[model samples]
Target: MTPITRSTAQLYETDFVAWTEKTVQLIRAGQFEKNDKSELLLSGKSGNKRF
Candidate 1:
């Protein structure tokens, strides 16, 4: 996992492609701590789910 820098929730709708690319890059880099787990999780799902 790689973490991306904090971004507003609106950014996902405003530029989904860029956001996805940035997210992929961050994950590939192994910067897990920077990723926003809450934002990534589906509503009603537990954050404890792990790979």
Candidate 2:
């Protein structure tokens, strides 16, 4: 892989991990906001209780 592409992928992975951790913390603390909760309710998943 190209150096630039590899670096970008690493950065994206790190950001994604950090975001997931923060989201979990918010959920555990009952601090999740309505707008953010809407985003987490993945369309069809919510309909089927897949979450």
Candidate 3:
């Protein structure tokens, strides 16, 4: 099976502002399914401010 890849994965690492903009846009547009759930969940687990 193919892994669920995140389009914003690199942005999350390189550009915090861009990543946040994209994520907020995705959420506001109700594109919840397109979000990187695994990444967010992992961030939540780690209590990361960057996520």
Return the clash pairs for model 3, or none: none
lDDT of 2 by residue, 1-51 (tens): 656788899999999888778888888888867225634645474473323
Candidate 3 local lDDT, 14-43, one digit each (tens): 687777788789989999888776556434
The clash numbers for all candidates, in the given order, read 4, 0, 0
Poorly placed runs, candidate 1 (over 4 Å): 1-14, 41-51
TM-score, each model? 0.45, 0.62, 0.46
| CA-lDDT, candidates in order | 0.66, 0.70, 0.70
TM-score for candidate 2, please give it. Answer: 0.62
| lDDT of candidate 1 at residue 31, scale 0 to 100 | 87
Which run of 10 residues does model 3 get worst, by summed lDDT?
42-51
Tell me how far the alpha carbon of residue 10 in candidate 2 is from the true structure, in angstroms, after superposition: 0.4
List per-candidate RMSD values in Å. Answer: 11.1, 4.9, 9.3
TM-score of 3: 0.46
The global Cα lDDT (0 to 1) of model 2 is: 0.70
Give lDDT: candidate 3, residue 28. 97
